[model samples]
Target: MKLRSLFAVAALALLVQVSMVAAAPVVRENGAFSCTFYNDGETESWTGTPGNVDWSDAQIASVMRAMDTIAGLFSNEASRKVNVSFVYVNQTIGTAASAVPLMSTESSPPYAPKTKTVWTADDLGGRGVASGSAASVNNLEDVWKYGHYLPSDYADVVVTISSALHLNNSLYYGASASGIQGFQFDMETVILHEMAHPLGFYAPGRSDSKTALEVLTSVKSYAGSIDPKFFDGTTTVAYLQKHGMGILDYPYAAYETNDMASLGVEMSKDGSHISKWVGYKDILMGDMALSGVVRRNYSDLELAMFKDMGWSLANDPFVAVPEPSSVILSLFGLSGLLLRRRRTA
Candidate 1:
């Protein structure tokens, strides 16, 4: 009887060990970038919930492909590496989703907790690191500006997507953005957008107080002219002056606020994103995305912004997306087809 009891206990221990191994989160690594997806059907402590929803097979496959594509975008390019942790949870986010750099430590005086900056002199190619440069002066303008790159050993950012997306079937999880349908949001596009934030396209507590009309008034100054000199770093003054909105010695008194309206630049209401200004809506970092639209390329302006933020581009980040006219025509065709189907039915 004693021997039989010992065998039963040993077998139970083996079963528990196997289960633990199976419940581990899935990790995907690409060069210096890596993403950890928590989709196993088990309770994750990070979520602060009992049991997390498991990502569907299709969802997992689609996101895995997106990770590969995003990895390629920064392949061998970042001056430093980053790791991100993604979790789907049943919780309230500021929006349907959010991305935040994981808190970290800095070796400076006071030794406050802060992430390292990604846009260091090495990545910016010494562009804005000089004295009196805009980039260096405002490096610590905001509370969150202490650093941008999350620690590489672990996830520097935690990207949280509401489980509501899963329940509502709101996202199109196809491998290609071109396959997006009229009623579905492109999954890859959303991922790319959120990824840009932690990759150094973020600042906290800033507000884009300008209305669309106010921003439009200054559009002609910088619409067609993009120069490297425009990125010296003070709000949009450096950008505007280079394109003729202001003179070389534009007065310093006008920069009292972070509003870029005077420079024809607009950001989201909360100042968390670049506004989808007319003729520049195709930028990947733009604030809004409509259903059936696939925004994959970073505009030249965006690349300059990243450069200002301190990252080295390994490959040319510019790629032409479908023209606005072409996109409108395709949407019209899709609408007509839907109308015909309704009539026939």
Candidate 2:
């Protein structure tokens, strides 16, 4: 009898394992997260770049993983998919007083050269802690900035990264976790954040090659109605990120709208970066930072919240139905009746 029961239990466990693996839906190489790798080593060698423009295989995988994480969350939470493509470049990079590369190849729609601007962060008015809490907006001139110059053929959104940033063997950065003592940035997090910028996650945008319009839109997105999801655990952010799930199809929201909640992100002093501001209290992982380095926050309420967002939050879909109030009431009433009978007896 014991042997039979053990065998049955083993079979059940195997079945459960298979079900769980099958349910999560593996990410394929060709789908929404279809990433393109680039190397910024041609000009510098900080992490793993051998030359000024080459990337090692390990560096490529790290960024892809970070994209996968955010993508996975959106996929699971919003029940949709986001197609992502990446670009690696070694444009003039440095701190605040940075070098801006003016290349003819960078001239195009949405890509602008923001070489002549200096930005400072301040409050919306005379205010409190909330003012410093978000990133200040930097004006990006598509006519003058490089975002428009980026090759847009076969690209919906493009993500660029640093070669040193992806190599964690020494300074180790990227998404895996704490890096070797050398690097401070996370490659995966950066990809996730930057990718969000173009997909309408951070702001609404237009494909206009017109510099004035995109700059205006980017500034607006930083402080605009941060998707309540970024602000809190509202279902809206997930819904926006994942619009198509299983056979169900959801319409994509406009790429530029405050409809998504946020902590108010703006550009850095150089206008080269944008995200939830740093050097302040760390925003939760999932919370959208003004910089490209964080993820959507998570808490115990995560499962319940995703369910409300319309994603299947059940551990076992067939068995995950909520408890019926009627059943509970019946059980309580029956217990009370039995207690009364005993007292009378």
Best candidate, lDDT: 1
lDDT (C-alpha, whole model) for all candidates: 0.52, 0.35
Candidate 1, residue 218: how far the Cα is off, in Å? 13
TM-score of each: 0.58, 0.38
Please give, for residues 201-237, the per-residue lDDT of candidate 1 as tens digits: 5543223222111111122233333211122333233
Q: For model 2, what is the C-alpha lDDT against the true structure?
A: 0.35
In candidate 2, what are the lDDT values of residues 30-81, reduced to their tens digit? 3234444433322221122223334555666676565555444433222123
The candidate maximizing TM-score is 1
Supply the TM-score for candidate 1. Answer: 0.58
What is the TM-score of candidate 2? 0.38
RMSD to the true structure for each prediction, in A, is: 15.8, 20.8
